[model samples]
Target: MKAKILIVLGLLLLNFGLQAKEKECIKLHVGHNEVPENLIEKKKSITHTHHLSGHEPVHIENHFGDVKVRVWEKPEVKVNIEITANAPSEKKVQAFLEIVKIHSEKVNGEIHFKTDLQCLASAFENNINGGDDKEERNFLRVDYEVWMPEGHDLTVENSHGDVYIPRFLSVLNLHQNYGNLFADHLKNERSVIDLNFGKGFIKSMKGGQLNARQTALLIDKAENVVMTNTSGNVKVLMADHVDMKTSYGSGHIDKVSESCRFQVKYAKEFILGEIMADVDKLEIESSHTNLELPLCVKGRYDLSTNTRNTDLVLKDQPKVHYITTGNDAEKRMLIGTTTETNATKVRVTSSYGRVEVK
Candidate 1:
C-alpha cells in the first residue's frame, strides 16, 4: 500500500512541474526604435528642408518592434525604417525594415506602416493556455513614435506608452492600456480625452490651453467647471465651478462660482466640513440617512430625503424660493433666518433628529 501511494504522489508532482514550466516566459522586448537619416536627407536634396512638410502625413499601426519616426520637409516623401530582433536570428530586424520600406513606397497619403508588439491571442485555441516561453496573456507592449507634418492629427488605439504631441497640433485622441498620456495644448474644439483605468493623472505643464472630459473638467482661470468621478473625488481650485453626482470622496471648499451646477449625491464615502451650496440652485439627495447643509441657499431650493435626515442653515436672503425637505422620519438642524415669522420655503420630517427651517 505504501509503494502504491508513493507512485501516485510522484506522478502528481511531475504533472504539477510541467504546469509550472508552462507559465514562464522569455525576455520581453519593448520601447521605440529610431529611423536612419541618410535614406531620408541625402536623397531629397532639392531646396530648404526643415520640419515644414507640405507633403502628405505619415500613418502607421505597428505590431512588433519599436517605431521611431521624424517628419522632414523633402520632395517625394521618403520614409526611414528600423526594427528590433528578439530570437535566434538578426535577420528579422533587416527583414522587417525592408518590408517597411517597400510598404512606404507603395502606399498613398505619404506612408502608413507599423512595427510594434503584437499578441497571439487569436491564434491560440485558449488565450490563457501558454508555455513558459510565452508572453503575458493580458498585456502586450508596442512602443513607437511617429512624426507628422506639425498640424497633423494622431489617433492611437489600445496603446501602452506615453503620447507626446506638440503645442499647436489639431487634435489628439489617445487611449492607453497601462501608461501615462501627455499632450501640450488642447486649443481645438475637438481636443477631447476618453480615458480608461490606467492612471490618467494629467497636467498641462507646457501648453497654451487644456481641455478634458466633463468627468475631469475644471476651468483654469475663466469659466466655472464641474466634474464627477464614478469611483473617486473631484478636485477644483478657487474661482472654479459646481460639482455633482460623484461617488466616494470630497470636493474642494475654496472654489465656488455661479456658472456651475454643484451638488453631491448620497454616497458611502464621507463629505467632511462645509459643503458650500453657494450656487443659485442647490439640490441634494440622501437615502437611508440624514445630511447637513451648512450654507444658506438663494435659488429654488429642492431637498428630498426618502427615509433619510436633512439639516440646513438658512442664509439671510430677501428672495428665496420654496424649500422642499422630505423625510420618512425625523431630521435635525439649527435654522435661523432674517425674519423668523416669515421665511420663503421650509419643509421638515423626522425618523430620529429635530427639524428646524425658518
Candidate 2:
C-alpha cells in the first residue's frame, strides 16, 4: 500500500511540473523577437526654400510643436523643420517618421505648409496594443522655423506649442490653442489673434482684433484695437481707439488717446488709468461689474445706470458741470461737461455693479 501511494504522488508531482514548464515555454515563445523595453530617440531636420512673389500669402498649420517666424528681405519663403521621435525600438521610430511629415505646396498663389500625421486612429491603436500598458508609447513632435519676405500676409494655426514673431510688418492672423504667443512690433493693418488657454504678449500692435478665451494678453502700445475676452484678462499700457467686450473677464488700460468703448457682462471688471482730455468719446456698459476710470477735468462725460446695489462715484472738478436725473429704483443718469462745445462724451450704464470716476 505504501509503494502504491508513493507512485501516485510521483505522478501528480510530475504532472504539476509539466504544467509549470508548459506555461514557462508559452511565456518565452510569446516574448520571443519582441522589442525590448528600452527607450530610443531619433531626430530629423529638413529645410525647404520656396520662391515667392513677395506679395502672396503664407499659411502654416502645425500640431504639438513650436513655430517661430521672422521677416526677411528675400522674396522667398524658407522653412526649417525639426522632428523628434521617441520609441521603444528602431522599427517604431521608423514607423513614426514615415507617418509624421510636413507637406508644403502652392495653392492659388498662396504658399501653404501643413504638418501631416497620416491616419491618427490607426497609429494610436497600434501604439496602444504594441506592448504593456506601463510602457511608454511612441511620441513625436515637430518644430518649425520659418522665414518669409516682408509685406507678405502671414497666417498661422498651431496647437500645444508657442508661436513667436519678432517683427511682422504686414497682415498677420494667428489661431492657437494650449500655447503662448509672443509678438513684438506687429504693424498689421487688420491682424487677428484667436487664442485659447494661453498668454499673449505684444510689444506694439498697430491695428488688430483679438478673441481670447481663458487667456491673458498684454500689449505695451496698441492702436485701433478690437478685443473680445471670456474668462480672461487684458492689459494695455497705451491704447488709441479701442472697442472691447468682456464676459467674466477683466481689463486694464493705462491710457487712452482717441476713443474707447467697453461692454462688460457677467461679473467683469475694468480699470482705466487715464483718459486723455482730447478723447472724443468713452462708452461703458456693464452688468454685474466693477469699473473705475480717472475723470478728465477738461473732458465731458455722460453716465447712466439702472441697478440694485450699484454705486456711482464721481470726483468734483471746477471746470466740469454735472447734471443728474432719475431715481435709484428706476434709472439714474448723470451728464458731465467740461466745455459747452465739443465735450468729450462719456457714457456709463450699469446694472448690479459699481462705477467710480475720479
Candidate 3:
C-alpha cells in the first residue's frame, strides 16, 4: 500500500509540473521572450541629501526613469538618483555619462534639481537644421527617490516612467508621459496633473478641487474633479462633482453626491451607480456609445435617445412616478421622471447608441 501511494503522489507532482511548463510555453508563444542577463549593464547610482531653512517649492525634472517623492515630519530633505545607460560597449556608456550633467541648486529658498540633457537636445537641433542626420544611438535613464518635509510644495515633471507620492498637504504640479502615477493621500486645495499616455490611480484624496488629464484614471475618493482623456478607462468610487470630456474612453463612477457631467465625442461606454436627490443635475451626451444608469432614481429625469433603443428596468417595489414619450416618425424618444420633496434633474442625449437603465 505504501509503494502504491508513493507512485500516485509522484504522478500528481509530475502532472502539476507539466501544467506549469505548458502555461509558460503558451506565454512564450504569445510574444513573451526571456532575455539573457548579460545583455544589459548594471546601473550606476548617485545619492545626496540636504537641509533647508525656508519652505519653498522644490522642482525636479527627469528625462527617463521613475520618480518617487514622499513627505516626512523632519526638517530636512534627501535625494537618491540612479542612472543607467544602454550602449553596445562600455566606452559608449562612459562617453554618454560625460555629456549629461546632474545639477542641483538652491535659489531663494527653492530647490531646483534635474538631469540636464543638453547634449541630446543640441544633437536634435543640429539634425533638424540641415546638419548630419545621424540619429542618437544612446539613451540615458535617471531614477529619483526624494523625501521632503510635510506641507512643502512640489513641482515634478518627467518624460518616461512612474511617479509616486505617498502624502502631501500643499500644492502639487506633476506632469509625465508614458508611465503610471499613484498618490495615497492628498490634502490640498487644488492640484493639477497631466499625462500624455499612462494610467493614474489615487486613493483617499481630499481636496476642494482637482484637475487630472491622462489616458486612464482610477480614483477611490475625490471632490470637484475635472478630467480629460483621449482613449482609456476611468473609474471613480465616491466623488462630489465630476466634469469629464473624453474623445474615446469608458467611465464608471460608483457614487456622485452633487452632480455628474460628461461630454463624449466618440464611441464610449459610461456607467453610473447610486445617485442622490441632492444632486442638482446629471447630464450625459454621447455620439455613438452606450450609457447605463441605475434603476432607482430619487428625483426627476429627462432622457432622450436618437436613432437607437432605450431600455428602462424598474425595481419590483417602485416609488417615483415616470412619464415617457416617443416620436416614431422621427426616431426619437424622451423619458421623464419626478419625485416629491427633493427633485433631481437628469438629461441624456445619445446618437446611434443605446441608453440602458437598471
lDDT for 164 in candidate 3 is 90
Candidate order by TM-score, decreasing, is: 2, 3, 1
Colliding pairs, model 3: 295-358
Using TM-score as the measure, the top candidate is 2
**Better by TM-score, candidate 3 or 1:** 3
For candidate 2, write residues 1-358 as lDDT tens digits: 0000000111222232233333221100010122236657778888888899848999999877789997778889999998776566675555555656688999999899998865343333322232233244445667899998788899999887789998888889999987889988888668998999889998988888888999898989888878898999989998888788888988888988888888988746789898877887778888898988776555455544455677877665553454456564443333355334665666677778897777
> Against the correct fold, how does model 2 do in TM-score?
0.78
lDDT of each: 0.34, 0.72, 0.62
TM-score of each: 0.46, 0.78, 0.72
State the lDDT at 126 in candidate 1.
Answer: 34
Off by over 4 Å in 3: 1-36, 40-42, 86-89, 122-139, 208-214, 276-280, 297-338, 349-352
lDDT of 1 by residue, 1-358 (tens): 0000000111222222223333333222233232222111111111111132454444545433233334433433333433432322233232222222223322544345444222222232233322322221111133455545555654444343444444534555454433334443444445445543333443332222222322332323323223344443434443333334454434433333433343344434323223234443333333322334333343233333323344433453353333334543433222333333322222323233322223
Q: What is the lDDT of residue 124 in candidate 1?
A: 24
Q: Worst 10-residue stretch by lDDT in candidate 3? A: 1-10
lDDT per residue for candidate 3 within 1-358, as digits (tens), equals: 0000000111122232233333211100000122233333436777767676767778888765688997777787778888765434465445444545678888778888888744444333323221211132334567899989976788889765788988787888888776778888776767777776777888966653444454678889767667676777778888677777776778887887777787776646877887766787777777677777774345344433343444434333254354445564222222234433345556676666666665
Candidate 2: worst-modelled 10 consecutive residues by lDDT: 1-10
Q: For every model in order, what is the number of clashing pairs?
A: 16, 2, 1
